[model samples]
Target: MSDALNVEGIIEFFEKNARHPLTPEEIARHLGVGRRDKKRLLAHLDELVERGILVQLKGRRYALPRKVNLVTGTISMHRDGYGFVSTGEPEGKDIFIPARFAREAMHGDQVLVRAERGIRSDKPEGRIVRVVQRAHQTLVGRFEQTRKFAYLVPSDPRLGQDIVIPRNARGKARSGQIVVARIDSFPSKNRNPEGTIIEVLGDPGDPEVEVLTIIHQHGLPHRFPGEVLAAAEEIPGEVLPEEFSGREDLRDLLTVTIDGETAKDFDDAVAVRDEGQGRIRLWVSIADVGHYVTEGGIIDREAYVRGTSVYFPGRCIPMLPEHLSNGICSLNPDVERLVMTAEMLFDAEGVRLESRFYPAVIRSRARLTYTQVRAMIELGDTEEISRQGEVYPALQVMKTLAERLQERRRLRGSLDFDLPEAEIVLDLQGNIEDIVRGERYFAHRLVEEFMLAANEAVAGFLSAREIPLLYRVHEPPSAEKLQQFQEFLSHFNLKLSLRQGQVAPRDLQQLLDQVAGRPEERMINQVMLRGMKQACYSPENVGHFGLAAHDYCHFTSPIRRYPDLVVHRILRGALGKKGLSEHEKQRLAQTLPEIGEQTSARERRAMEAERDIVALKKCQFMVQHQGESFAGIISGVQAFGLFVELKEFFLEGLLRVSSLGDDFYHFEEERHRLVGEHGRRVFQIGDEIQVRVEHVDVERRQIDFVLEGAPPAAAQGDVADDGDS
Candidate 1:
C-alpha cells in the first residue's frame, strides 16, 4: 500500500461501514496508508473524535457516533429551553436535552445527538453535537427597533432567543409590530440567530393579524400558487362523455349528501336499500377527485403538499383550489358527478357479506343538512319528511343500517369519546357573537357510521389482495400513561379492567359508558383521550385502536384529504392492472413512506393552527367580558395553578395558586389536585365553582380567573376546609 492520507475519505469510510468498529492500524491499512503516513492517520482519527463524528472504544477501536448509541433526529424544543430529539426509530426513545445542553438548537431543527451513556432510565438523555439541517428558515415574532439595530422576539417561545437585525436590514417593519423575518444567519453556540424583517403582519392585538402570524409560523400556505390554480381552472365543469366509458351509470339511484348546513364541499354521499333476505345494500359514493387532479400534475403536487384542508371558524384553506374542491370535485345535487363507490352488502346484524369497489357516475338526488335529517329521522317532523320526499324512504333505510353498524362497532370495542365541540359563532367582522356547544344528533352519527363501514371495507379488501395502501394506524398506549390514567380515575372511584398489563378499547368504552351523562363525564372523557396515542397515516397495517378496527383507512373524503385521494388513485390502478407492476410497486414502496410522514406532519400542523386560531378568538371574546362571574369546572391542575373551563364560553383560564390569597396550596401530583396548607381546601378536576374573569392578555393568548366563592354543594368534599372562599 502507498503512503497517503485522506481525512474526508477516512471519515466517509467509517460512516458508510458504521456498524463495524476499526482500530487505528486496521483503518490505516484499509485506506492503503503505509507506515510513513501513520502519524497523519492518527492525527486525523483524533480530530474526528474531537469533532464527535467518531467514538474511541475501550479496546482502542473507533466507530461512528451512532454505533456508540448516538442518534440523529429533529429537536422538539420546549419553551423552557430544554428539548427532546425525536429519533424516528422503532423503539421511539426520545433523548431529553436539558436547558444548558440545548446548544442554541431551535424547535424542529435537525441535529445529531449522542445518548448519555450509563443513564439507566426509561427516557434516554442526549446532547446535540451537530446541526444536520435547520428547520426554521422564516421566523414570526414581535419586532423591537433600536437606534442602530432591531431584534425579533419570537412568538414561539421554543425558539428561545431573539434575532438581531442590522440597521439596514430592518425593512418597513416598525417597533411592536408582528413581523415575519427571514434568517440571514443561524445561531452559533454563543450568539443568537440574526434575521431581518421580510414582511410586517401588523399589530399583535388585531385578531386577523394574530391568525396570520399563526399561519405563517406553521408554514401553512393560505393561497394556491398561480400554476396550481391554473391547473384547477383547466378541469371541466362536467364529466366528459369519454370519461364515463368505464364507470357504471348510477344516475337514477336515490343518493343524498348529508353534511353541515354551511358545508360546500360534498365529498361523500350515501344510498341504502333493503335486500329482503335479512340484508341491506349500502352505496358510499365518494367524489372521484383523482380523475381530474391527475398524478404528477401541479394540482396534485399542491394537494400532496397541503395533505388536508385547513378550516377555521369562518374561513377554509382548501387542499385543492376552489375551482375543484367547490366545483367539479364536489358531489353537488342534480348534476352528473364522477365517483368511486363502495357497494357494500351487510346482513341485518351488520356483518359484511360482500363488498365491491368501482368507478361510477351519479347525480345526487338531494343535498340534506344534518339538522334536517335529524328532524326527519329522530323527531319525525312532518315538514322535514314532506320536504325530503323521495329521499325520505332512503334515509329511513340508511338510518336502520347505520344503527346496526354502530351497534356492531360497539360490540367490537370501539372507543367513542362523544365529547362536545365548541362552536364559535362570529359576526361578519370576525368578532365572536356567541360560543355554544355544537349538538351531535343522529344525523351526524348516521353519516359517521356509513363512512366507517366504507373505509373498513376498502382497507380490508386492499389488504386481502396484498395491495399497497395508506392505513390510519393508532398504536396502543404506553404502560406509564395508562397507569397514570388509572391513578386519576381512582379519585372518582373508577377502575379499568387491565389484562396482562395492557388495556383494550373495550375497557375504556366501559368506563365511558359508566360516566355517561354524569357530572364528571366530560372530565373523564378528556383524560382518557389524553391517555390515547395520536392516529397517523402509515404504509403498514397496524390497525386502529380508537376505532377498534382490524383494517381502516381514509377513503371517503378525497376532495379534502390527500390520503383519500392517494387511495382512490391506487384503487383505480388496481382495478385496471389487478396489481401494481414490479416497477410501479418499487416506486410506490419508496414514495408512500415519505408521503405518509409528510402528510402526518401536515395534519398536525393544520391542527395546531386551528387550535391557535380558536384560542386567539376565545381570548378576544373574553376581552369584553372581564370581571364577569361565570360557573366553571376545574379542568386541569398543576403545581402552579388550577385551570378553569367556563360553562358559558367554553373557554379555559388559569387560576394561579398564588392568587388564592388566603393560603399556600400544595400540589398533590398523585391525586391530580391542590391542597391548601393552612385551610386544607382541595381543588381538583371536575370541581364546579364560580370564577370571575380577572384579566385577558390577547397578545399572549392567556386568560386569568380568580375564585369567586366556594364550589357548589355537589362539589363539596371532606377535604374542603370551612375557611375556603
Candidate 2:
C-alpha cells in the first residue's frame, strides 16, 4: 500500500505473483488499493501494458511479459539481413532472429519479441510482435536514378534495404549524389521503405562531402543552434572583478597546462609542491563552465543534447559554442579565469591524506606541450629546461609524484593495455600525407595520473556526503564471456585461473604480464578487452573495474563532457553549508537516471562516428598502394577469413578463405585458425606473413588482401561469417 499509485508498485506485484494472472479487480485488492486511488491504479496498469512491460491474457487478466515468454529490447540488424534483439538486462541472452523471421524491424528499433526455441537449438530465437519506436526517421544515403524510377542506397550496410523515391520526391538530387532522405513510410513484408529527399549534399569522393556524410549518418549536431549561439554571445569574454566574489584567489599559484600542440580548449591546469618528509600538495584547477551556462538555459540545453565533443581527423564538433568553450571557459596563459579547484595532500605512499573542493580564480603561468615537458623532465634537455625557467622545477616534482601514483596503481592490479594508435597527417586539402604511429610520452602519463587522482578525489568527496550524482562505472565481465576467453587462451597453452567461476582484475593483469613480449601479446590484449564490458555513466555506484578504483567519476573535462558539468553543479550545491535541500534531492532522484542513460548513449554515438571517419580515411590512404606487398601479422581469424594488420601502416584488410587456391581450408572455431585439409598448412592468429593489397573499397570502408604469390581467385564466395577489422 506504500506506493500503490506508482507503476513500479504494479510491476512488483506482478513479479511476485508471476505464475498467476490476475484481473484488475484482483490486482487492486492484492495491492490494498483504496476506493479513492482505484482510478490511479488502473491508469498505471494501462500504461504498463502499453509499454509491453505487462501483457494481457484472456478474461482481462494481466501478467509480467517475461512470465509469458516475451522480451522487450532494441534490435541490432546484420548486414546480411539477420538480426539480434538484446534483452536490455545485464545478464540476459540475446534472442536470435533469422533472416526470414526478422519481419520489417530495422536496426536500433525498440520492439516486443516472442521468444522461441528451434529443434536441436541450444539458444533461444525470437519473432518481433510489434515495434514500439523507430530509431531513424531520416537517413543519409546515395541517390540513384534509373530510366523509369529512382532509389536511394543506404550508406550503412546494416540498413539492408534500399529506399524507393517517388518522382516528385526527388528535390534537385542528381544521380550518384549523396542525400538525406526522410522516411515517409517504413518497410513491409513485400515492399521497400519509401522516402523523400529533404537535403542534397554534394557528390561522393569529395573530402567535405565525406565528412558531412559521416556526421549526418550518426545524427550528430555539427552546427550550434542560433538561439544557443545568441545566448553564448551574451556572456562576457573576460573575468570581471565583481564575478570573483566569495572565490579563493589562486591567481599567483605556479600553475601550467600540459596538452597536445593543436589543443585549443585547456580545461585543466596542475601545480605541485613538495612538502617535507616525502609529502606532496597538488592542485588541479578546472574551468568553471557552470558559471556561464546555467541550468535549463539555451546554451546548457544544447550542451546536454550534444553530451560530448566529437573529434575527427582534422576537425572537431564541440558541445558548446566557441565563444564559451574556446574563449571565457578556456584556461589560456597569463589570463585570469574562473575555476573549480581540487586541492589534495598525499603522503610518501601516494595515498591521499586530505582533500577539499572550492571555487577559485587562477592565472596560468604557461601553456606547455607534452613534448616539451618530456624533454625537460625525462630527457634532461639543457636548452629546454633553460627555456622553461621557473616551470622546470614544477615539472620535475610532477614527474616524481606521477611515478609514485603509477606504482601504487600497478600494485593494485590496474590493467594498462599499451596498444598502438594511428596518427593521420592531413595536408591543406584534408588529404592524407602520411600515417604514422602516435608516440606515447612520459609527460602524457604524468598529466593522466594527476587527472585520475583529481577525479577519484572528487568522487570520494561527494559520495561520502551521500550526494546523488552521475558516476563513471565499469562493471566486471560476465562469467560466460570469461569462459570463452579462457577457452581461447587454452590454444596458446595458457590458463586463466578463476575462483568460484569469477575473474578479478588482478587475474587479467597477471595474464598480461605473462605474455609481455611474446608475439601473441597484442592479440591477447585485444581479445581480453573485447571480452570485458564497456564503461558507462550511471547514477548507481558499482566501482570502476578497469582502473581498480572503488570510487570514480569524470571531473576534468567539463567543457567537453556533460557528466562532468553535472558533477560540478552537484558539487557546488553540496559546497554550501545547507547542502542540497530536500526538494532538490527529490528532483534529482527522479531525473538522474534518465540523464545518465541519455548521456551514455550520446557518448557511444560520438565514439562510433569518430571511428567510422578514421576507418574511411585509412581506406582512402591505402588506395594509392594497391598491389604493394607488406609484412604483416594475423590479427584475427574467423570462419570467413583471416584479418591481416600491416606493419608499415596502421591498416587492416581481410583475406577471404576462398583466396587460398591450393587447398580447401577448414575453420577451427575453438583454436581460431584455418587449416588446409590436403596441404596440412595452417594459419592462426599472431602468425607473420606477407600480403598484397588486392582491393580497397572506400565507400564501404573495406579492404581486401591476397597472399603475395597466389593467383587472383574468383570473386569471394558467400561470406559465411563476419570478419574483424
**Model 1 stretches with alpha carbons more than 4 Å out:** 1-64, 88-94, 117-125, 577-579, 709-725
> Considering every candidate listed, which one attains the maximal lDDT?
2
Cα lDDT, all candidates: 0.85, 0.90
Q: Candidate 1, residues 1-725: lDDT per residue as tens digits?
A: 44336667887788675458888888876788888788888898888776556767779998886777777688988666789898776447788988778856889987878787425676678888777678889999999987777799998766878999888878888899999999989987788889878899999777688778888888898889898888777778887888888889999888999999889999999998899877999999999998898898888888888999998998888999998889998999999999999999999899999999999999998999999999999999999899878988888888889899999999989999977877899888877898887899999999999999999999998888788888989988878778888888888789876776589998789889999987668778888898778899999888999999989999999988999998898888778845677677678777899899999999999998898888778888899998889999888777777888888877789877767776767889777789988899999878998998888877567888888862322121133321111
TM-scores, all candidates, are: 0.88, 0.95
Model 2 misplacement above 4 A: 1-3, 17-50, 56-62, 669-671, 714-721
Alpha-carbon deviation at 656 in model 2, angstroms: 1.5
